[model samples]
Target: MLTLYVDAAREPNTGLSAAGAVLIHQKAQQQFKSPVFQSLDNHAAEFQGLIWALEQLTDHQDILTVYSDSKLLIEALHKHYAKHYQDQVDRILFLLASHRLVFSQWLPEKDNLGAHNLALQALKNRQTND
Candidate 1:
């Protein structure tokens, strides 16, 4: 089973945002973090992390389980429960259906520190580079 942990971060003053993900697949692990273009809000940034993680999979039969700290992202994906970012929510659901998406759990923020830190780092990097 492939397990992915995803998170997002934003700079309040600059409105800069980043998405991060840690993927555990087979015996290997992959990490990704990047600044989001167009400076999306927290919800869109967080959902983009999951979308980016899902896009990393090349196999259609791969079983994927996702862990996130964002309740909005989880509920949006699982329950179709987002009013504003319905497009992102629908896109994530489509990706989930393409893969063997089994579990989408909401973990405590502390439990998702790896991805969280990565997101912060990405945001910082974007600031520094710009």
Candidate 2:
């Protein structure tokens, strides 16, 4: 089984946002993180992070569980309802249904430390590269 934790952040006064995700396969004790530029709202970024994480999975047959701190995103996914960002929402939902993915809500930033730090580091790296 593979479990993933995801988070996203948007810079204040800037449209720029980044999404980050960390996947841990407990049985194998392996982990991975991905941080990418997301030219969208925080909600979109969160959903995108989940999608990105799912895309990284090596085995589609593995039991997949996704964790995120965004309640809105969790609720949306749980309800199978579409949000304003129809494209992103549709994409994520399609992936979830296709893979038979499981969704869970995680609160308290401490629990999502790795993904959060990766996102901030990605922002720093982007700035440095520019």
Candidate 3:
């Protein structure tokens, strides 16, 4: 079974945000860190990260179980709705449509350390450069 873990981080003072994701299947693994060029909130960053992660798997044709610590992202995917983030939610849905099966599940923050750290590093790198 293929599993994905994703997270996003925002520098509160600067509103610098980025997305991180990890995909794993047995021995194969991939990590991603995408900077959200636009200054978005953490919730929005999560969606951007998800979209980036899904884009990397456009050729993948199997069940994918995704885990994230953002409740907004998980719930939006489950119900297919979001108020302020409706566009992001819609984009995520569009991305999912290409996959055979994808489950957006939630986990505790501590459990999503891989993606969390990636997101933090991404944000830090962006903040440092720009």
Tens-place lDDT per residue, model 3, 2-110, is 7899888877777777888888987688888885555567777778888888887745777789899989889999999999999888988887786688887899999
Candidates ranked, most accurate by TM-score first: 3, 1, 2
Give the worst 10-residue stretch by lDDT in candidate 3. Answer: 35-44
Query: Best candidate per lDDT, number?
Result: 3
lDDT accuracy of residue 40 in candidate 1: 56
Local accuracy of candidate 2 as per-residue lDDT tens digits, 1-130: 7787778766655655666667777655444445546555777777777777667677676677777788877777777775576677677777766555565675777888878877777666666766
Name the better of 1 and 3 by lDDT.
Answer: 3
Which sections of candidate 3 miss by over 4 Å?
A: none
**TM-score of every prediction relative to native:** 0.90, 0.83, 0.90
Candidates' lDDT values, in order?
Answer: 0.81, 0.70, 0.83
Ranking by lDDT: 3, 1, 2
lDDT of residue 127 for candidate 3: 78
CA lDDT, candidate 1, residue 64: 79
Encode model 1's per-residue lDDT on 1-130: one tens digit a residue.
8888999888867667887888887878888886454445777778777777677667657787889999998887778768988888888888888765578899999999999988889888878887
